[model samples]
Target: MTSEAKTVQEYIDSLPDDRKLFVQKLRDVIIENLPKGFQEGMGYGMMGYSVPHSIYPKGYHCKPTDPLPFMGLASQKNSINFYHMGIYANKDLHDWFVSEYPKHSSRKLDMGKSCIRFKKFEEIPFDLIGELVTKVSVENWIETYESAFNKK
Candidate 1:
């Protein structure tokens, strides 16, 4: 469910009580492990971690005024979804995450191109997510994004 909240805290505050803690913990994991030069804000109605325009002046090609989105966290109707652009743009990173997922959670992985959906909140592997966040730095993400989506 897309939120209409204007800020990260507002987005969090709007979540159902059952989802608040899981989402918060996931947010904490991402924030603690994310490399330098990324900023946290609300974008597309979710909690987004991005490379601010100060670091990448071009911004997102689809929306030049928005920051370059690297990751996002949202509470969906049936799951908490984590979106990582690096995993979607970098095959090596995608392969690494796909291979490692089974080791982290007993539940079978439920994922889309870049969105990892956690249907069972109790089984969410914050540690694995933390490690994944550290795998791509701001510079690496920008390079990967440009190569994969911004080719001219």
Candidate 2:
């Protein structure tokens, strides 16, 4: 659900025992694979990994005051969310994930444009998730974002 917590630790602590463990594991994977220049924080009421202002001073295109979002992990009302902005912006990556996920995961893939929803920890495709996180580097993300922004 929407977290009222102001910090990432606070958000983690707010989860139930089972959910806490699940999120923590997911968080660990994200952190381990995350590229340099991305920092962890709270964004949109979720635990977010973003391109900090020091790296991308323009901040998020939609909200100049906020950091540019890369990924986000949230314990939502119905499921845990893995939000991947990289996949959302790249058609090939998105298509690959959709095709490969089923082969790797036991649970049915439940996803949106950028959100992969896990109803249970067992539904998470940890290895695939790790690979996805590493697929786009910080420099690559900035280039992609700038290209899209220039097109607008």
Candidate 3:
């Protein structure tokens, strides 16, 4: 593994200058359309927007938390990953997404886990992504993630 970057900003800042554009743009879109209370963090390795351990230390697994489920976004080495279903074990909405937006060029979104991996700028439909991010409420996302958190 890499020597994890110090801050989320540092992670993004470290990317190649040319690579910065896609991540930054996607990051901006996510921030604008993200549900309330979610925060941006450096998870795994990318610039992930999460619900913060301070808010949900128990995670989506084990016991339930008072707050609803949340999501995250990260810019990875080869692709930008959108994590709406962290360890959720499943995703019903993924089916809806795949069937609806089935025209990807590189076509590499691993939908069984709700992770949309887009390689380049033109591959993703930002408007649809924005709509998807906006479609689910915080409560629904939490419930959905928690509901399937341990099943798989």
Best of the candidates, TM-score: 1
* Better by lDDT, candidate 2 or 1: 1
Pairs with steric clashes in candidate 2: 1-76
Task: Report every candidate's CA lDDT.
Answer: 0.93, 0.91, 0.62
Tens digits of per-residue lDDT for model 3, 15-113: 777667777777778778887767766655555665655656765444334223355556556766676663343345666666657553346555436
C-alpha lDDT (0 to 100) for residue 84 of candidate 2: 97
TM-score of each: 0.97, 0.96, 0.72
Which whole-number lDDT from 0 to 100 does residue 125 have in model 3? 71
The CA lDDT at 30 in model 2 is 93
User: How would you encode candidate 1's per-residue C-alpha lDDT over 1-152 as one tens digit per residue?
Assistant: 88999999999999899999999999999999989999999999899999999999999999999999989999988899999988888889999999999999999999899999999998999999999999998999888888887576
In terms of lDDT, the poorest run of 10 residues in model 3 is 60-69
- Model 2 per-residue lDDT tens digits across residues 1-152: 67899999999999988789889999999999998889999999999999999999999989999999989999988788999988889999999999999888888889999999999787688889988999998899999889988999
Model 1 regions more than 4 Å off? 150-152
- Quote the lDDT for 49 in model 3: 60
Candidate 2 off by > 4 Å: none
